[model samples]
Target: MTADPLRIGILNLMHDKVDTQLRFTKVLSEGPYNVDVQYFYPQTHYTSRPVPDLVQKISQPLDLKQVATMDAFIITGAPIEQLTFEEITYLDEIHQLIDVLVANNIPQLYVCWGAMAAANYLYDIPKFQLPEKIFGVFHNYLRAQDPLLKGLPDGFLAPHARYAELDIDKIMEDSRLVINAVTKNNFLFSFRAREKNQYFLFSHLEYGKDALLKEYLRERNANPGVEYIKPQNYFRDPLHMKDPEFSWETTQRVFFDNWLHSVADHIATQQFVKE
Candidate 1:
């Protein structure tokens, strides 16, 4: 008998989590599995004020029970600062959630900050630290062929924006996670969760042109005391440079499609046994 479609639950932790969730859904839905995305937002902001009701309305907190019911779950990055992994307020909850997913053998994916969260939870590595904020389309080299990048080009670009970054050397030390892709600058990375058939990326694969623009503006407004100047000042005349043919949105969809296929294959094989 044929199995039911794979049900996916997305855990969005960022202020713009819903946007990323929707973009991911759009890409995954085009694949074989039935995609169902859910958003999760934190209660406090970097400044410790309650997130506005409008933003809160878009996402709800997720628990282990809720996560157990899904075939797969995805966690999005957030715009928060952490000197150390433990310093993050939601670190404990994220760790618990990851444990539950791993213990239950649930497939999962994490993007950007979500990647950092998984690395910290699984390897006890500190949060990524960077000398400057990374933004715009970044080039990454694929190490080996995996189902996740089945039909995509050999090299691709993804959107990025983060002051902190992970140490690739430390990530390499952890055998549980497999490094799928890396950048020449070593600022971006992608991985697959071997035990759970999950994936993680340290770039924004789901961000569209407008979404990137909004992020640029938000970063500009926040003025996080970083000396890095805004892209607008440098690329003022050719705004489309932000959304080149090798756009993050386009390449991200390819990555998302690969995830859907992995989920579909897992569901097909009846390998998703709940713990």
Candidate 2:
């Protein structure tokens, strides 16, 4: 008999909301299993900024009642990495949502700032500001054989664009968290809390080929006077922005496919136990 479609929810907090949804949806749809995706945003945020018409058509304000029904959830990264946790206007609402997810034992995948935020809120792993943004496609070496990274090779390339780093020492000291992957510089790539059914990815595996390029251009235009750093090791010709390689395409497909498989296994196991 065929299994039910995986009910996955995404709490998208990125500025380019539509692109974020599309990229993640593409990766999530790569596997064999059917996936039902629910997109959400912080209602408190919309109260201040005008909700984009496209966002309104595609997503809803975060609903605690509905969040519990998801088999798995993804929280996307925001551009607001410079701000303190308390400085975030909608943090309390997000905390409440996370608490509900925790209470329901929902599997979570926190990407970039979302990962940092969740790490701070749940495990007290504080985020420290970096002198400059780590903007590039870096090689990430696998450190553990976690189910989430089942078929991936020893190393893979992933995009990074952040101004903060999670306290590595604190995470290493925390017995509950398992460090899965890290860069040669020892910057974290991915980690998981087995007890909480949570995964944290500092790198952007779901980024499209032009994602970083668009970000660079957008930032450049937004602040014409300010000198912006081009995404390193990304453009074939840094001057002209020539044919960029989609190096992480296969890696993302495999990673997200493994994640879905892992989630499916967890669901099956839970069902078996309940039976």
Best by lDDT: 2
Model 2 Cα lDDT, one tens digit per residue, 1-275: 12789999999999888899998888888776899899998988867679878888889989999999999999999999999998898898888988988999888999999999998999999999998888888888888878867767777788888889999889989999989999888889999996778999998888989999888888898899999888988888877877777888877888888888878987988899999
Estimate every model's Cα lDDT from 0 to 1: 0.68, 0.88
The sequence of per-residue lDDT tens digits that candidate 1 reaches over residues 1-275 is 22566667776776665566667667776665566666665433334666667666776756578888788888788776445665677677777788888887778788788888787777765665676677666677887566777666666766677778877777677777677877777665687756666677787777666665677667767786654434432233354635434355557666676677776767767655532
TM agreement with the true structure for every prediction: 0.83, 0.96
Candidate 1 Cα outliers beyond 4 Å, as residue runs: 1-3, 42-52, 224-228, 231-246, 271-275
